[model samples]
Target: MIDQAKQLREKMLQKSSKKPSRQTRVIAVTSGKGGVGKSNFALNFALSLTEQKKKVLIFDVDLGFANIDVLLGRSPEESIATLLDKDLSIWDIIEEGPKGLQFISGGTGFDEMFRLDETKMNKFFHEMSQLQGSVDYIILDTGAGLSYENMRFILAADDVILVTTPEPTSITDAYSVVKMVQAKDPNVHMALVVNQCTSDNEARATAENFKHVTAKFLNKEIGLLGSIPHDAIVPSAVKRQVPFVLAYPNSQAAHAMKKLAHGYLKLPVPYKLGLKGFLLKILFK
Candidate 1:
């Protein structure tokens, strides 16, 4: 399976080598803790990006709860583990969700998959390199908190959007993530997204307070990537297995998501290293 995927990838790479490469931004969307609506935010955010006519792929790296497929009411037969264990190309594992958003599920055995031999690891990286210029953004929906797997993706990404809420515990944990990331790599660019806000004032206050604390303690200025209001339509859409941005486009949360997408696109991308650079950092750093 590995050899065949490699041969096919090489052929495709050869054909694409001569063409101008499109720079892909790899952004990791994570949170301080679970239940902050991190995964949901990641999914809808990707869909919102697609609404703006941008090509986006959201990879669910939350090994324990790989619900990107489930959220779309999709039951994928293959996942990242499938590509690692079976005969398939990286493209084979990528599944298209609502609004033409492409995603790859984080299969079971999330920990053991990386313990495999180095050759398979290299092949995986080589396979992923094909996506360097193939998409506009690769959003990695990583697991919350400072787990080893989550940190690897966070550190390697060109930028990370840390999702949090107005709760005190959520803010504390989010700050912890910032401190850990800053300690490891101060150059790692990170932004904050306060989700499930009751009002614009509350959202601004939450984000501003977070920004203030990080700057004062860690001397790190986290960018505010806007906030999402607490709308009932979000859970209803979730129950229906549809992204709110698609199911209820006129809802307050949906409108906020659209604005978030536009704001994200306008933000300065100062650390775009493309897919290959991202893989190198993840695999070797």
Candidate 2:
């Protein structure tokens, strides 16, 4: 048994070290509804990836409600707004957090996002693509619901991780978002993260429920990433502006996030840069 455990550990470590073939695995963290801990999940998820020694960037694309900075207990010196004005590179706005994770704040509102004309839109994509080569993963914390901005980022990501609690409303909202995204692009790859569940069984049930509804109505497959149990340690860590994964590495929630990071390790690296590749580098830099 000891030898087997050693071999398993070695295998896991080997898998984690294998670099993703893609420039970056762009993942959009979205929820069916607000208050499901979507932003917190996004922050901690990125931090967890960093703990695994993977280079990660958190794009706080929540627009007006961006709080990734707050989650990390830092005030932003710059934001997506600076990028829009061509005043700073994406690197300029990136703030280092616990575990050496980097994060960029989303702008303050939809009006600025909507105001992006063809020139600025082109510039924005260019800068976004540039970061692809420098990071292993880019996690976008999108605002709740199925707005045009949310759909845009969801479709652009290499994968989408939908977060929801066991609440009926959260499930419904998650289902609705999935339906909307599918309607726009049927082939979108999506996964689920069940947060605030009391038990693993409850988390699995929530994931199963989402899978069934999505398959029945949208004929889409939704992957189950993992779950985080309801733990006071999470909020307690939040109060300190430290990621639970780092603030309390031995905590249950931290362990679950580590498991989720391991699960992410098994996924195939996304290699294609697409049209946004060159554009993102230029504008963001």
Candidate 3:
């Protein structure tokens, strides 16, 4: 059994490493508002994907708040701020996370970097372009909102995973993001994950309602990326400064996150994004 598992691991690694492309698969995980557990989802989701042998990188681009490093019990000295100001390579700011997961911290205290002009954006993109060929996926965890920054990242990503809770306001705000994505880039692949639900039925009902409203009002079709239950283990894991997926691997949220990671891989990858194209998408008009 041990030998078979080892072989399977080797096989997955070989397949993941062989995924050559013009650009990495960029997926931005965002939300309409905060306090929806977006940060936790992003960190665990990336790590879970890594478990499947996918080379994963998290670009923590949240302007107002940054939580990934804190959640992992590590602090990064440098962040995207360094890239915006200094002549730093993408590699210079990347901090290593658990199990080879590479991440770039957000602009925590540097408010100026958040309001970047075209010149600053161009330079930032130029630096980010250097990471074009390095990984299988580049996941952006943007700040929760319909802010200009969030929208830019949302549209730029090849896939947008919008996180929301089961609350009415949360669902309403999430649909607002969907409307914006549709207006900006109707063709952008969009998915919704109902977080902090208590049961599968609740999650599904919320997802269905959101999908129905979006299809009816906005005429947009959004994929349901599955739901994460309101697991007690989540808060415990958070307090311990570890991912729930790692701390309680068999817990409800952990299982849900793993399944979500698997669903992410099943997404269709028709082509990869080139460096220039990637920058253009992020720096959209």
Candidate 4:
């Protein structure tokens, strides 16, 4: 019986090895504190990527205060809880958002995710694995702070996008979050996105201040991805349940988000579907 069990394990390992791996650009959008427009950034960033014709999946992992669905003006028929109940698959829970983007809403109740057991963990991983080959990017909209569940998702992602505003409290909290994460994972790739800045110079200064502090204290390098200016059009669009990028493409915030998308994702200016088409043809075979 021991020999038979060993043989079965070997076969399982071989089968798993043969399963093709999908190239997914997983990005976690996290902030040090709440009310810094983290969800807004996540929603707009996914939309910007979808405009480039990339298949993006935005996962609303903000357990306590889930708002991605509200931001998209969507009421999903199913959610992560539905999937956990085995009544729906990952694909079944995905709701189509603006610009053809897909999203998975977080659980509606205020249940702590850290209570998940090994069996539930396995099930969740299997559900996420189903996203393989179907999505080009998976944006994890994590809750603010360094909760155990939040850090777990942040560490699992390929990159972490730290969101912050010009407020003193926001900046300080942002630094604290980064410091905590670095203590756990020294080589984690981090990118900074400054939001609610008054002007280009203000954004640059805020990012520089963060870079300076991190380098001096933690001896770590934080890449400044880009910034979004404080534009009234964003809140106005939100009130109407529309993403600013789609609602007011000519707005300053919209244009800045597009530029930030191009810079962060390393896509060419005037980002178009042609870039993704070219990449898929050359790299996805």
lDDT of 3 by residue, 1-285 (tens): 335434534543455456545357788899987899999999999999999987788988887787788889988777888767766656667776788788888765545654578888878877777666667788888888888878877776777789999999888888888888888777877889999998899999998999899999998887789889999999899999998889999998999999988987887845545445656766655
RMSD in order of candidates: 3.3, 8.9, 6.3, 10.2
- Ten-residue segment with the worst summed lDDT in candidate 4? 269-278
Which candidate gets the maximum lDDT versus the true structure?
1
The C-alpha lDDT values of all candidates are 0.85, 0.77, 0.80, 0.76
Off by over 4 Å in 3: 1-22, 109-122, 269-275
Q: Where is model 1 more than 4 Å wrong at Cα?
A: 1-19
- Residue 30 alpha-carbon offset, candidate 4, angstroms: 0.7
Mark the 10 consecutive residues where model 2 has the least summed lDDT.
276-285
The sequence of per-residue lDDT tens digits that candidate 4 reaches over residues 52-115 is 7677889898988888888878887677776776545555666767665878887764243345
| TM-score result, candidate 4 | 0.84
What is the C-alpha lDDT profile of model 2 across 63-144, one tens digit per residue?
6578788778898766777778855555556666676687778766433665577777766665655555467788889889
lDDT of the structure predicted as candidate 3 = 0.80
Model 1: lDDT equals: 0.85
Give the alpha carbon lDDT tens digit for every residue of 1-285 in model 1: 456445645644564465546578899999998889988899999989988987788998897877888789998887878788876778777776776687888788756655667977877887788787667789998888988888989988998999999999999999999999999989889989999999889988998898899999999999789899998998898899988888999999999999999998997778568788888887777
Clashes of 1: 0
For residue 273, give model 4's deviation from the true position in Å: 26
